[model samples]
Target chain A: MGEFELIRRYFLPLAGQGKSRSLILGPGDDCAIQRIPAGRDLVFSVDTLVEGVHFPKYYRPDYLGWRALAAAASDLAAMGADPECFTLALTLPAADEQWLAGFAEGLRAASDAFGLALAGGDTTSGPLTLTLQVHGTVDEGTAIRRTGARPGDLVAVSGTLGDAGAALEYLAEPAPTPDMAAMLDRYHRPRPRLELGRSVRGFASAAIDVSDGLLADLGHILQASGVGASLDSARLPVSPSLARLKGDASVAHALRSGDDYELCLTFPEDRWGAMPESVKRQLSVIGVIQAEAGLYLDGTDCSAGGTPSGFDHFRGKG
Target chain B: MGEFELIRRYFLPLAGQGKSRSLILGPGDDCAIQRIPAGRDLVFSVDTLVEGVHFPKYYRPDYLGWRALAAAASDLAAMGADPECFTLALTLPAADEQWLAGFAEGLRAASDAFGLALAGGDTTSGPLTLTLQVHGTVDEGTAIRRTGARPGDLVAVSGTLGDAGAALEYLAEPAPTPDMAAMLDRYHRPRPRLELGRSVRGFASAAIDVSDGLLADLGHILQASGVGASLDSARLPVSPSLARLKGDASVAHALRSGDDYELCLTFPEDRWGAMPESVKRQLSVIGVIQAEAGLYLDGTDCSAGGTPSGFDHFRGKG
Candidate 1:
């Protein structure tokens, strides 16, 4: 099928039939139109996931679609912006009907779950790559940022970390334990912490979604806010599957592995008591922001060493 | 260099040093933030140009950069929305410093000319692909659409057409006359008529940009407006360079060539007198809208014909 035929059959229907308040115009025009509420600012983010880099080419098409949107949505979560709508610019090797159907289903699932409209997008042919741009809205000057973490603020993380990296390990292993299935779920279908992010808007001094490992992404907050952090290795949140692993392996996974999609944030210690109870229960205090200028692990300095780097896609052998 | 370093060095510098009144926050965060003026709505469009599909793999990085942004900006022009910020998601096989430098220079030029901030973007490793999402703003409910054309309204177009296609033909010839250079420039860097588009806000009833040939794109307006059109073949504006082409080649080029990046619109016949002289001089009243629903080229019916299709990347013998 041609581009329009595939989009008409697969994507037009996926744009969602339900009416939306913020969407003034949907697909079918040169541009899609949306109205932001008065006094609100819009958060815009663009992320692309490429096969053989971001994920394996053989990954499930449905999960891939979900993951692409969820990954983009996580940026909005970090900014504490409510889900609005998103555009998908998809390039594929061919228009496989089965694959398109699976992708559409997962896209729909994420759209419905997040209450975001499909908005508009483009479809073309190339090696499989998905570029998603999400538009979200937050009250003026109320959105959380990565530049507000001050010294003495408490550092915390929502949900468990290192599970997605474990899922990658499971994919390579000939036989993975039944318990690893949960880690796989965490990897394939990460729930963007939208509600929790929104709840923490005024309280969270600084926030960032952990895509590039805990320390690396949190390091962004520290760098932006001009502060350091002392992470208590024992307090770092990890799933039961990861906890079962050996000491260093689990610690490395928690601190150095990426693709967790969990939110690593900092806020005033006093505000913890004011956060909604449900949100409070979902978070774990892992560290404290410090005036010193580097990351410390278990009271030891480990900031300037190792491949302390996350996956740098472009550095891969081309 | 890795993706982030490349972004930090090249893309970050091109984000522009101008202080934008609407862009409240710039890159470095998960999402860039912009405030839309009250009583206005946001217009969004995304375009993906994959190497070997949209353009040759060896095309100049500078032209490719300009073309990518201009093509995306054209969509916003069709909506008669004012220029705003944009996000780019680029995938590349490897980072060639020379190519990156050229691309960044062209990007900076376009970003300056359009007054668009490089809000945020992502870079990754893959076969070279560039996806750009442009956001523009129009007064709420005043933005022109493709569904408002009516019978008897004059069919019009802004700037010239067919030079881009002529440029393609020139590219294949290996060596061409100096005249073809202008055509190639049109193909590589056709201006998005944002000023004309904004001027037509209250005047044009229906509008679209000619990316998929003049007739094909105007046909889109007809389809949406549930109307037909009649073109005075002789009146279709051909670029001065294209007008020099011999016989039917020039006519076909004017009508069937795509990537013109010019506006195709319909407006009231009487209201033509009220248009600013500058805008009127720039627009060509090539045809008239009709109630019967199909495109007639100078009284000849060529709707159901041969490879009379535009560039659809997905349908390449698949």
Candidate 2:
């Protein structure tokens, strides 16, 4: 079969099932069709992950597929949109059936988990790359943005941070404990906090997905909101596995290392006590938004006359 | 500034403008928030063009940018959806300011031409590739599909075909001719027949975008519709430029050569004369659908006994 036939056989099935009423048409047409709900806004984001750049070249195809979809979907969650559909633009050097099977299985798992259906996309032969454009919807004027943080908002995050970075460290090195392996799995399969994001619709003043380390991604929020933040280093969320590896430096690693894919958000302190127990268990109050314009660690400015650094696509040692 | 900064400066301005009633929250957020029109279906498609794979490695960056958007937008047009918004996922080996400037210019031109607003996307370090995901809208139960063709329907196509293939030949060995340059331009900047598609909404029984050559792309319509077709080679729309390039073999090029991005559709013979004159100017009756279940060339069955070929991503030679 040709590439088109292969796509029709493998990918089209993924598009047709569990689709929302908004999806008027699925795959098999020139394009898939859907309707945006009235009184809601569509949230869209695209992310590309290339082999050896975004993930290790030796990574399994299944995890690669899961991670790629999660990374893109995380952005939608950050915007407090209900995951609707996604289109995957996948490129590979050659069509290896085993690899394709694994990839499709992983993608299907992610789709089912996230309540999203594959809409339509192109499959081509090239270096291994997966680009996913995810579509979502949120009620009008209710979607969270990066530029809404106020000076007195409480800085918070869902789930542990620095685990993905720690996982990467373990992946790059030799054998590690089972705990470390679990941390690595967290890195590979980040569960986007879709439900929590939706639940905190009116609570969060600002929200961002942690792809680049907290300092850098949150810096975007600070920049857009015209405010700064003071992240208490002692309160930073570092997994026990990471703490075991780096001892006291774990806080620094958690602060600077990225790819956690957790939601970093700010809410008024008044709502903190009313937060759900589940959310409270999952999240930690790490800091507070400040009137000044720059990230800080325990009141001292981290960007004090120095360039802010995290992940740089052109220069990062990924 | 690096690639990320360059993108932030140049491309960010293109987002969050125009009739943004559907946009709840726009650029500068973690993700773009759009409202899917409540009762209408959303149509989606994605296409990726890699340097040296889809276009000539040395092709103009601006044209590359335009063609990439055109290729994806054409899919939406074929689905009879109103052009809306698009997200671009661009990967480059390095940041070249001149290349980026030209590319951004081309993107802006296409966005203006198509009335599609730019959405959020990702930029990364990798082999030069551009993946575009275009989203459009169509009313419920009104969007055309590929599986709607019936037996005895009249097969038609919009605009001339094979010019892009002829253009490829001219680019390979510069047999410089004004007609050849025009053909090359057609390959580089295909105008998607969105208006014609929307106009022929109730008329077309089945439709597809002609990216993988006429016969192969149309084969999709036949398979999905459970019908066959007999395409008259003499009736195949060939430009004056292509007629000069291939002489007697022009028919072969029109049948097998890809990258045309035209529309191949089927309509009931009874509705033929009622088609709009503007659409008639762009469309031509090429063949008739058959009771049998395979594509044909004139009267002979072409599906079973012919060598299947179009654009093969891994094997094609520029």
Best by TM-score: 1
lDDT of candidate 2 at residue A132, scale 0 to 100: 91
Residues B1-318 of candidate 2: C-alpha lDDT, one tens digit per residue: 765587787787767556334544545677876666667766778889887799888789899878888888898878888887888889988888899889988988888888788876788899998899887777777788999888889999988888887787677655677878888888888888788888888888888889888888888888888888888878988888788767767777777778888899899987777887777788889999887887777676768633364223213312
Over A1-318, each residue of candidate 2 has an lDDT whose tens digit, in order, gives: 568767866677678546654565666677876677678777788899988899988688888878888988899889888888888889988888888888888888898888889887888889988899888888787888898999999999887887887777678657767878877888878888888888788878889998888877888889889898888877887778777766776676677677888999999887767777777787889999989887877766776533455223213211
What TM-score against the true fold does each predicted structure earn? 0.95, 0.94
TM-score of chain B of each: 0.93, 0.93
The models' CA-based lDDT, in order, is: 0.85, 0.80
Interface RMSD of 2: 1.3
Tens-digit per-residue lDDT, B1-318, candidate 1 = 877679998888766636345677878999999888899888889999999989987989988888889999999899999878888898988899999999988888888777677888999988999999988898899889999999999999987888887788777667777678888888888799888899999999999999988877887888889988888878978766677653455777778778889999999887777888888998999999888867777686555432245323212211
Worst 10 residues of 1 chain B by lDDT: B309-318
The per-model DockQ list reads: 0.87, 0.75
